[model samples]
Target chain A: MNEIPVGSSATIVGYTIHNAFTERLREFGLIEGTIIKLLRKAPWNGPIEVQYGHSQIVLRPDELTNIQVKRMM
Target chain B: MSDELPQNPSLIALVGSPNCGKSTIFNALTGLRQKIANFPGVTVEPKTGTVKLSGETSVTLIDLPGIYSATPKTPDEELTISVLKGTHANITQPNAAIFVVEGTNIEKSLFLYAQYAKLAVPTIVVVTMIDAIKGSGGVLDDIELERQLGVPVIGVVGHRGIGLDEIREYLECGDFQPPLLADNQVFTGKSTIEDQHLWAREVAREVARLPEMDSFTRRFDAVLLHPVVGPLVFLLVMLIFFQSIFTWATPLMDGIEAGFTGLRGYVEGIVPAGIVQSFLSKGMIAGVGAVVVFLPQIIILTLFISLLEDFGYLSRAAFLVDRIMGVFGLQGRSFVPLLGSFACAIPGIMSARIIPSEKDRLTTILIAPLMTCSARLPVYILLITAFVPNSLVWGFLSLQGFVLMGLYIIAALSGLVIGKIFKSTLFKGSKLPFLMELPPYRFPAAQNVFLTAFNRTKAFLTSAGTTILFLSIILWAMAEFPRFEAPQNASTADIERLQLEHSALGMIGTTIQPVFAPLGFDWKVTIGVLSSFAARETFVSVMGQMYSVDVSENNESLRVVLQRSITLPAALSIIAFYVYALQCMSTIAIIKRETGSWKYPAFAFAYTLLLAYGAALATYHVGLLLTS
Candidate 1:
């Protein structure tokens, strides 16, 4: 998921590991097959910003690394 | 469910995701009739307010911390879930719930509502920010929404108080019905999370005609969130934030100081020239005046914070700083609390409750005091004016201003460094995931901003004022007693000095003088440092009392007196000590309350004391080397 370029959309496959945090993401509508767009990445290899289901969320790179995604663009 | 009403005042819970305008709606409904409700054995305190539904009909409203789902992930979510489930010891089960949903993002909002449906509690769905949705050329079919969810739905511009009458009417009627899910199988019989999202999206599609895009938030975020421009704008915003607190508050602060001085003079004139006069003028008036003069700065700081928060810029600021904060082993959520510390540590410490991770929250609280709070401003200004030259440096900035800025930078850097150390050592753990929603910008409502600033300032005054006033009288009595007669030929200044040296506070200072001597602090300065534990600004007032000078109008006379008696190295050392010391009693008490244990506060005090002493000693020696 972190490899997706900015301004691109992708479909979530599933989480590499499921925990409370990932469960929360799922509850926020990041369920498998949901499409999410990578808005931008913070400078200095920081967190990445993404939009999923009308909600913009910022997450660290490590968090995004746990999810598998197929690029749509 | 029981058929009869539970009690006289039905308890209603307000639940929503963060940045859903839930708090604005709460403030609108409750106005000033609100108080913090603390649950037993829980650090999180949900605010409870009385909402008047109609004539002789009112309900107790609990504003729960925002959550994304019924499954608890954070302490805040745990508390909300427990209270909603009627398991929290201090709070009764809410008779009903008001589920707030953002009109602009109904699809995302409805997902949470789907999860909440399992609770089977009667709920009224409030669609807030309807104006924003309509302004962008969208429409919400409330009747369709009501039919889709099988519950009452009301649309409201919360801050503007539109569509609120219908809500009050519904509540007053006391006929709330639990959501019926007979046809909504997407949420029935242990459905998967994906099914819930599908149901919410389908319902939103039918009931909400969303605009093609939210161009307003996008246009602003283009610049505000740009990789290069975002940080620059953030820095500029911070620059303005600090500048207004210090420069803008000067005139008002001066007026307050002058008023107190005039009051002191009037009291002294009416009272007899004896212990009574001294106590009235020096003990009560001077001590309280010294602390009260900083009120303008506190108000300004709170105003800026409230405006930024209400306008939805705080979350963007947090987003911009998340990476930088990660370097210090903290996430973006720590930014707001740390920023509040610059105004005062007590509020800053309390605001650390927003951080979801326990270790991160504790570390943030432990290092919050290291930020240069406003209480340290007077001490810094007094010392800098006395010792630092006033000439311009680099042909533009004044040397004193430069030094002041340098001190602030040093304090901030030290706080970051200490935060890193604590995260690695005492609160060692893996880095937690950082997730935050970037709320869309809105024009802050004027009433909410001012009310927030007013309430915060009032809390600060009442809490810090009483402690300082009590300590001031005790310090005054110690300095006024055990008086000695002046020699026939001695001057008034000599007699005053003699009386102070013979007093109990003076004797204690003399006895402890040797311990601080290596740091270039004289007996008088030692006394000031000791008294400062009551509050940081008290050190300046203590100096004024010891020197028999009025610091209310200006510190000019006091500065001159200090320059004559204290060496340059000593002044710098004192400034260094003030910069590092955890000297405020109110802060310590608050830390104890927030952390629910004395262990952290005790460790904080001991470590800060050692750091202050060591830094003062190092600074004193450096100054001596440069001078010699």
Candidate 2:
């Protein structure tokens, strides 16, 4: 999960959304069972853009580190 | 229908997710008939417009800040949520609400709709971007959606006049019923993010037909979002943006300056000599004239920015720069506000509302003024022209232009350094998620771009007319009072000098001379710096009036007089000072308005002025050392 291949599609299994910024990610359709595909990862493990249900969003690596996802092989 | 609903011209709150085309729909609903103003005690502008209902009844529409859910994540979202909940005392609880959703992304859009439904506010869901969804081989069943949600759902292509009549017809009927779902079911459904996602997805499945891939968007993103190529492209675009501000606006600026000069000449010829003529020709015309010349630069800047925002490239640019910015502990969202600061800090600070994290938003606001705003341009150009030689380095770069670019670079570096310090010390340990959405690129609509540019230009002109006009008159009187008698056989320069020396401004300048002596500013230069506090561009006008009187010759430009009088060290010091100083009163006033506290603006002023003084002192000594 830490080094998932680029352009891989995954199903978010479980994730920890911190209290300080809750509801924002969910509002963008990033939740458990929501299928997401890594569209592009910025250089150096920086923020990456993902396709989340007909929309694309950028997420910092630090924020995504805690989110558990099962890559669809 | 509720008997308690307000009579004719009922208030309707238009809410939606960001990039859902809420503003476009607002434009569609209201046409060229909206007025934008801030909610009380805050800087978020709620655009209000009136649209005729069925026959003759017109209803007021409040276009709220875009948010994903009723739960507030940012100050702007809180404003929307509070207003809907009837807790925001500034605005009345809306009689009804128009919940706009992106039909292409119904899964996420319906989440907000469900949240709004919990309030039982008689909401109508307006599905926007229906054309884009259809183009991408997706289907949005509006009738099915209407039946499932128990609310009126109308698909609309906001830019074109699609499905607008249906919306108006619904509003005109004035028969909005509360959503069919019970409050408990709407608010308490499984009470988890996963559950909500599942619920929204199920609803979307029942409503939407099919969508496999976003082929067109992905094709563009493959090239535009490439790691190596994307950043280079973004840099090229920005270079053009910054370059145009200088090259493109020059002619328009010249035209404005010529017009002002002509007016001043006409006034001087017609008005009787003495105080009346001097005040009208020199004080009023010259002072505001200098500020007005900057109008073209501000317009060109916002015009480019609005175009970028409209075309949906700004968010992608933000994504590209986020990593570099994150290294300095600033979120990617900070990029937009910082770029906006280059045109003017007022809009820059206002746009900080987009940043989700309070800490990041605050830090961005604190450092935004450090970005060299357009107001500093007049002073910079004047100083650079007067002191810096117009020689080319390496046969490619003009020295003056390079120095101008150097000032911008220095200001930007200062913001990064300041941001780093604030991150580790003042705004510590707030780990807010940096999640940014990138909307698909589209050609910018001309009307929206023009409207944005027009609004910003109008704001600038209005401020000039009121604040700058008032300050000009006051400073003029200060320099005009306490007239002195000229000695026999005295030259016109001597008489002018004597009058200024004896005037209130001159005395104040002389008194403050010692305070700035360490920075190498003389009394005359000190007076210019002092007057600039009202508005930064006023520095040039103050200098123009102070020096124009002594020149005597009509053709001798203020640049020559400045060159002859001021030393290189002093001019450099002034330029360095302006690079960091928060001298524009409007910026401070806006900071106060946005943060809803004088403390932040006070801190902003103190820190920036300290930075300015220290930088100026260092620059003066360094220049002296190198020259000697």
Candidate 3:
């Protein structure tokens, strides 16, 4: 997930750990099989901005590491 | 249970995700009839307002904290869920819930709505930002949404009052029924997040066409969120924010000060020139004026905050600063409150409520006062101008200006360090994963912005104002009593000085003088420090009174008198002390209210006092060594 290029689309596969944070992400429409686009990453390994289901969310790098995703062409 | 219910005014809860225009709808619906109430044992204060449903029928509208889910993750979310479940002791279960959703992003909204539906409260779907949907070339069939979701759905541009009449009609008619869930659609309070997301997506796809990414937002984000340019833009924006507060609010503050001075003069002229005149002009008027003088700064700070928030830039700014603030164990959201502390810590501390995490919020509140508020500027200026030379330091930088800038830098550095220390010691916990919504940019609604500023300023006045006024009167009495009889030939200034020397505050200052003697502060300086607790700027006035500096004369006379009485080491020590001390009564009062306990504010006061004393002691000794 960290290596995903900006503007690339991906499908959420599953979470590495289930917790309140991931649960919140899911509630914000980051469920499995959901298509998400990597909008941009903040400078200095800061939070990554992602677009999923017409909503843009900023998630820290550690949080993004928990979610496994498959890149789409 | 039935008997416990209120006899009238059914409670309606407005629930939605953060930045979903929930507050805008709330402000529009309630207008100016709202009051914020703290729930028992929680820091979250839900705002409730009386909304007229009909000619005589009125309902209480409670605006719940925005939550991403019914399952509580933060204190705010916990409060929302507890209130909705009727588990909160102070608030009864709302009779109905108006689940506000953004029309442009209904899919994300439905996920929370699906979980909310299981609570079985009669619910209405309010799709706000409907105009944004149309502008983005998408369609929302609210009627179809209503049919699909089994609840009354109303689409409205809340800021503009469009479609508000339909919403009022629904509330007035009292026709809200519990949502009728289909067998497969029943959430059952046990649905997984995945299942809920899928269900919400299906429903949203069925009823509304999802809008494309807003072009304007995307274009703006490209520059504003750029790695280099984003932070630069953020810095520029913050510069403008602080500059406006100082530049714009100064005239209004000066006007308020002048008005109060005129009023005091008028009262003095009418009242008999004795304790009565003193009480009326000094105790009451001066006390009230001190609190009222902060109104312009509070209004401006809150107005800027509301504008940034409403325009959807605050969160983006938070994102830009998250990494840097993370190093200090503070989140990006803490930036705004800390920035606001420069204007006044009262508004800054109050604004700390925006940080969702309890520990983060508390840390921000605790460190806000360390940011060197405007109240500390007079003390800093007096000391620097008197002691520091006006000669240029680095070819162009005036030594006086450089010293002032250095004091500000020191205060900022100490704040970051103390914030980190507190986070590690007292507030240590697992860091909450930083998750924020970069809400789409939109034109800020003028009504909402002004109302927010007005309400916040009003809250400050009502809650903190009374404490400040009361303390001001008490301090005034302390300084005014124990009148001394001077010789018949003594001048008015000499008599005034003698009176202050013999007063209770003077005696206490003399008693505390030995304690601060190591820091090079004399009894007069001690008295100035003690009196400044009412408000930091009072130090200058107190010193003026102690030195008998004529009010008609400029600060030059006062500065000369101060320079003659106080040594260079003492001046440096005083500057060091003022840089760190939590001297404002209003800040302490607001902290007590915001933290919902005296414990945190008490702790804050103690730690800052110690820091101030130690810093002053160190600075005084260093100055002595350099002079020798």
Name the candidate that leads on DockQ: 3
Regions of candidate 3 where Cα sits further than 4 Å from its true position: B1-9, B38-42, B182-190
Candidate 3 per-residue lDDT, tens place, B1-628, comes to 9665433428889999888899999999999999877565657889998888767788889999998888888888888999888998888899888889877788888888877777777888899998998887888888788887788888899989997888787677656757665233355554777877877888888888865788899999999998889889999999999887777888998999999999999998888877899899999999899889888888888888889988989999999999989899888999999998888888788888778789989999999999988889888888888889889976998989888888889999899989999989998874356778888898999989998888888788888899889888998999888876788998878877888889998999999899999999999999999989888898888898888888456789999888888999989999999999999888888998888888988999999999999999999999999998
List model 1 lDDT by residue over B518-621, tens digit each: 99998889988987886788789778867878776789999999999999999999999988899987677667767767788898898888989999999999
What is the lDDT, from 0 to 100, of the residue B285 in candidate 3?
Answer: 94
Give the best candidate by TM-score.
3
Give residue B402's lDDT in candidate 3 (0 to 100). Answer: 87
Off by over 4 Å in 2: B1-9, B54-56, B183-189, B287-291, B340-362, B373-405, B423-431, B463-465, B485-493, B534-572, B585-602, B621-628
lDDT against the true structure, each candidate: 0.83, 0.79, 0.86
Q: Write the per-residue lDDT of candidate 2 for residues B1-628, one digit (tens) a residue.
A: 7567634438998988888888888888887677776555765668888887766688889999888777786767888999888998788889888888876678877777776766788778889878877887778887888877887788898878799998887778765656665454554656565666677788898888656556766777787778999888988987787667766777887899889989998998889868889988878897788567667776877788789888888888888888989889898778877876886777677667667677888999999999998779878987897888999999989999999999999999998899989988999887446778888777777777877777666755664345556656777788779878878897756676678777888899899899999999988889888878867887876677677553334323888888888899988999999999899766775676567677898999999999999999999999999999
CA error at residue B396 for candidate 1, angstroms: 7.4
Q: What is the DockQ of each candidate?
A: 0.68, 0.69, 0.74
lDDT head-to-head 1 vs 3, winner: 3
Candidate by candidate, in order, the iRMS in Å equals 2.1, 2.0, 1.6
Report how far residue B136 has shifted in candidate 1, in Å.
2.7
For candidate 2, the docking band is medium
**Across residues A5-71, which tens digit of lDDT does each residue of candidate 1 receive?**
9999999999999887788888888888899999988898888888876678888888888888999
Give the C-alpha miss distance for residue A15 in model 3, angstroms.
2.2
